[model samples]
Target: MESQPILATGRLLLRPFTLADAPEVQRLAGDYAVSATTLLPYPYPDGLAEVWIASLREGAERGDAAAFAVTLARGGDLIGGVRLQIDAEHSRGELGFWIAQACWGRGYATEAVGAVIGYGFSALGLHRVHAIHFSRNPASGRVMEKCGMVHEGRLRQHVRKWGVYEDVDLWGIVSPIRAEIPHPLRSMPV
Candidate 1:
């Protein structure tokens, strides 16, 4: 696979991250309020953004990831990011995203997520796309819900974040195309 295509929404542009974006990515994503709710590490270390940005292309080239810099469509200011970690063999992708704390409550997360899911199902031919959020952060779960994901389940003490175990809520949406394919077990005699 080559470079991921740029995605557009009414108020935002989902574009690939560049080396120049390292500073803003560091500034916005490094915030404690933003990092606390998501998987981003607190006291975000120096030069980590550059290293992370540099590493994204390898996954894109392998057709296994699509990491985007979320920006305002009008001014092109970097606001946050969204991604899909693809599992081609299983025809699915794990979705993740974050918005700068200043931009919260404006629906950017919901819009970007919807676009990425559309890309996953249509462009990537994924059968299912899912996301998970720390159970304490219902706002993130709300973003997933607004995108039409169902409350799949919860895992007790599923992830160790910042040295503490945190429960997580799983959410998912299967492609409409999935129903077109027959399940192998559907035809099995009970």
Candidate 2:
């Protein structure tokens, strides 16, 4: 696959990460509130954002994953990120996202997620897009719900984070059928 394509939505834009975004990525993703809910390591480590951004394009090229920087449509300010980890053989992908704590409750996560799911099913030909969130964070689950993903199930102590085990809630959406309907014909007298 080539570089990930830019995805635009009504209120936001989803574009591939660039090295120039590292500083803001670190500033937003480094917060304890952000890192605590995500897989990002705490204290966020120096240069890690740049390193991660640098790896994204190659991963996209290899069909392994695609990560996008979520930004405001009007000002183009980086606010967060969303990613899809692909499973080509199964025609599926796992969706993950994080918005800065300051940007939470603004519907940004839900909007960004919807766009990515659309791209996954329509552009990438994915059959299913799924997501999992730490059970403690119902807000993330709410975002998934708003995007039309159904609650699949929950895994008890499925993830160990910050030296503690956390339950995970799984959610998913399958591509909807788009077959055309046949037009009705006039009936002839028998």
C-alpha lDDT values of all predictions: 0.93, 0.91
Q: Which ten residues in a row have the lowest lDDT in candidate 1?
A: 175-184
Candidate closest to the true structure, highest lDDT: 1
lDDT of 2 by residue, 31-144 (tens): 999989888988988899989998887889889798989999999999999999999998889998999999899899999999999999888888889999999999999999
- For 114-189, candidate 1 gives per-residue lDDT tens digits of 9999989988899999999999999999999999899999999999988899999999999996759998999999
Off by over 4 Å in 2: 177-190
Which runs of model 1 end up more than 4 angstroms from their true locations? 184-190
Candidate No. with top TM-score: 1
List clashing residue pairs in candidate 2: none
lDDT of 2: 0.91
